[model samples]
Target: MLTFFSLVAATLCVSASDSTVELTTFNAGVLAGVPLWRERMPFLLSELPNSTADVLCLQEFWLETDQLAVVNATSDAFPYHVRLETHPSATPPCDATPLQAGLVCVQTRCPSNDSVDQILCALLEENCRSELRAMGQRCLNCLVLGSPNTGLLNDPLSCAVDTGVSYSTTNGLLLLSKIPLSNTVADGYNIATGEIDIYARGYLSAEVENLGTVVCTHLPTPNADRLDAPYFGPVEFNSIEEQQNAYIQQLMNRYSSKSPLFLMGDFNHGPAIGDTVAAEFPQVYQNVLDQGFVSPAETRVGLCTSCLDNSLKSTGSANVFIDHVYVQSQHASNVVDAKRLYEAVLPIGVPLSDHYGISVTYGIPVAEDPIEEWKTAFTAWKDAFREWQKNEEEC
Candidate 1:
């Protein structure tokens, strides 16, 4: 008992020291048909590898092919990656005509018995399909031609289906770590998500060696009316936002530990203080702040995360902040420095994404023995809980 108490004392006495990891979060705009995506995506695709980030959290990585492209490109720098593959169920067949329109043609149309294969082959053409297939692109996942079984093109009777998500783009939350990661957990919100529920917006958590647990997520937009953008009373949207924030807190409790707990992603809301547009979703960031998560961007002046409107094509004349990063203050982690990466390509000055990327370097204290350190942390946590309980009773 004395030894255990001593260990607890050691844990409590642990001080913040120098240990840093650079984390970057960016919303890489969807792959849907848009002129801005056409112009900027290529640049982003090339530049991400060169960017300096120990860990990268990306949102709006629409297609499986695009996900693969990122994984393959950064195989050297970020060998470890977790994608929250959060897409709506395909119980109903998929309609992919919209995606088909912009595809590069390889050969003249060919006749095939397979309804799905025929549409995919006609859309992709022979050469282009074959090439994209070689790159592991499949019909249902993107514009490439691969297998008919998973492509939603197999049914011989019909070719019609809904196009909201013609193919599976998933929830668009992806995490890439230079260090090895394990015990990944991901899911969409349990509450009703309304119109954009099909997107399956959710959080992804992974345990990184020495870094404790890191969570990457993209919450659903606060507006219940995604299509019309009608301004309903705060009660409708705020309630949903609060529920989502509670869910996020539950995740942090489930995944976080004695080491640093870092949360990075597009919360669809800005920092607590600035920007009128992001102010609309106050409950989102406020909940995180209430939980003792610290953000460096909150302190800086004139901080804006979003450069473009929701459409992802046009630029915004007014400043709008949304993306955010939160680090747990209870842990033995300290921020070395934090900054935002604004990717503005020269000549046209077109930003690589609709949202600017935020990165933070965190410093963690090292202990001599890993096992003892964990035990000490566990004891400290228990003691704190008991102390809180005692205080509650006194109150």
Candidate 2:
């Protein structure tokens, strides 16, 4: 009896120790023109030393120097792991460089398993090659069709050539952890707008031994303009609404099976306003919400304020909430506390990235059934929406 009790206690202790969450903020796209590389990267990383997040997902991360500098700086503190996805626009030609051969590293502290890292790296490289090929194919098709707007084909390909085929890598999602990642899948979603191609984004699912699944994604920003119009209806991409919806639909469809999911990324839209994608696409948000997912920041602080400064402001709008962290409802119940981390107005003279970062701490509850919770939440939300529709029609 004593032996069994001791084992149980030990297991509990280990679980408690592993159940910590930490998130940090780094000014990813800050550096310019090499030389002072080391100095440039660390400055941004230093922002998160206090939080010491278990997983660090940075945006605007330069593929060349910034990624390496981050690995060096954080090596001593978090000896666990690190992974990076550079911007698609920055990638060089396939023949010019090894696929994903840039400085982006997936640093981890698991037992020395060359096969594992090799496989993961190979997967990353293959995905990059596939994406580039797809982009190139699209460009070539556009050129052959003789559309005057060869801008898409010319600009991205040119950028790829100039930046070494690895520049502006879009899916810059990283997974850092002390736990071992048992399995991973990079699911790509095709985002379209009224049959016109907008972009493709990917969702990365990493299974951590006993911790279940963690999904990382970098959703498309509202930058892909289908036309000269400034905004689509009240939102930026109304014509592409169906495409965006399809993408989200695909995401939900693929991951719904993975109950107790934890999703983190730059959603590029917020729940604060009655405008924007989250607002315009409430049904999509509702679908996720129905599927038992909850936005940690939204639940904790209601809505996050604009994280952008004037320099990062491409659009003139003052109200914007672009970044997000959402967890399954069952996962949210385990969550003890959650909040937007970098709310401090930039120090008098210091320049950070245009967007602030968010951090949330979750406490896995003792008795939570993820699957059951998801079904209930989703059904309730769907029913409510149906009733709302009925009221609107009658009115």
Candidate 3:
């Protein structure tokens, strides 16, 4: 990590015409609240300011302490920030009512949402595999959704041993910008059932003074079978690829008028699925591109984002990228530079988070005449000097 002084120097050195602003997106991993977090979080905070990012988007900031920690740490550099409240506004499918037998069907099976809810509750009680099996198809449904509610309950399943501690913490999106922000909007996805129902998965957007509309969000991880996944609600990342796309599209349509849009976050799914994957599986990156967002071309600087998530990492062995920054295609020309902040992780030789941060630079255009502006300034200075001289002579 560069020193704060070095960060300031770098910021000052960038050209005026380009007007480079560093935008960084990182997943704080604060939800886990693991022992490593105690050490890594402070270090992570110290390192960020050193990068001198003009805007920072963070995901998985579940706990109030985690939110406060980031604010306290970066308050000086990023005077403006918004931590989206986790209270979901969308209507939950099961509002204290049991899921009807045939109400929620998946793969031609009538597995009640209540059964799934029961299985989730049982898992919290630390139910064994045999016990979970007894919970039946609903448990199976949980498995299909991923993680079998292991990380959902109080006594997480063995599979979630690593992240069990974090299960209790509530995570959401955070956006911090050096520039003043206005017209803030935050909302959770519409998924009100299964594993995704527990947490608020949504996007946050705000208008920056110089920059266009800036947004930060974290999409649900791709399901085990994208083909069979339900096409309903914003939370479930199953077959409803179009629904997710629509959510973002609506945002762009609503906010693009105020400013060119810049979206940054851990989308959880991307082109990493590979071109060979089934045509039915949703291609999130391609969808974004179709919506007129421009992702940076493959470059050495844009390294794999999911180094820690073995399951999601593109390569089974090596790390691959899932986090991203996208500019509204119409504003792509203003993009001065974009790259990953690969060094933001593990300053003390331990992992701060599974993913490294990424950054982008934008050059907002402004009409100006350098020579004439200088002449005008010189004329004003000369007049002021003469006035001062006359006043001095009178004295």
Best by TM-score: 3
Order of models, best TM-score first: 3, 1, 2
TM-score of each: 0.62, 0.57, 0.63
lDDT accuracy of residue 152 in candidate 3: 32
Worst 10 residues of 2 by lDDT: 142-151
Is 1 or 3 the stronger prediction by lDDT? 1
lDDT of 3 by residue, 1-395 (tens): 33434443444342335466767788766533233545566776777666567888998766544676778888888898887554422222222212222222221232334333444333322233233333333223223222312323232132223433221233357888888999887765543232333344667778888677788888654443333445432233434465456566656666656547788888665554343222222366677788778766234254566664422222234355667787787777777777766443354665666666777777776645778656655665565566556666776
Each prediction's Cα lDDT score?
0.59, 0.46, 0.56
Model 2, position 231, has a per-residue lDDT of: 22
How much lDDT does candidate 2 score? 0.46
* lDDT of each residue in 1-395, candidate 1, tens digit only: 23444545655775545667888888887544233554565676788888788888998776665677778888888888888653533422323443333232322354555433343343223233333233222223433121122332243212224333334456667898898998887665533232223234667778888877788888655432332232121123334465466557666666655346778898776653544443636656777777777677666433667654333545334455677777886742467777878656534466677778888877766655767767767878788667656666776
What are the runs in model 2 whose C-alpha is more than 4 Å off? Answer: 1-19, 23-40, 48-50, 62-64, 80-170, 190-200, 224-240, 273-283, 308-311, 345-351, 365-395
Residue 68 in candidate 1, Cα distance off native in Å: 0.8
lDDT by residue (tens digit), candidate 2, 1-395: 22433433443331112355553322243322112333334555776434457665564443434455556666665544445443344323333232233212212222223322322232223323333233342332222121121222322224234433333333334455555665676545532232212223456667754556677766544432221222211123443334445566666777778866677776654554543323423454565577677877665655433432434433425455546667777666666666655545344433344456667776543444667656655665565566556666776
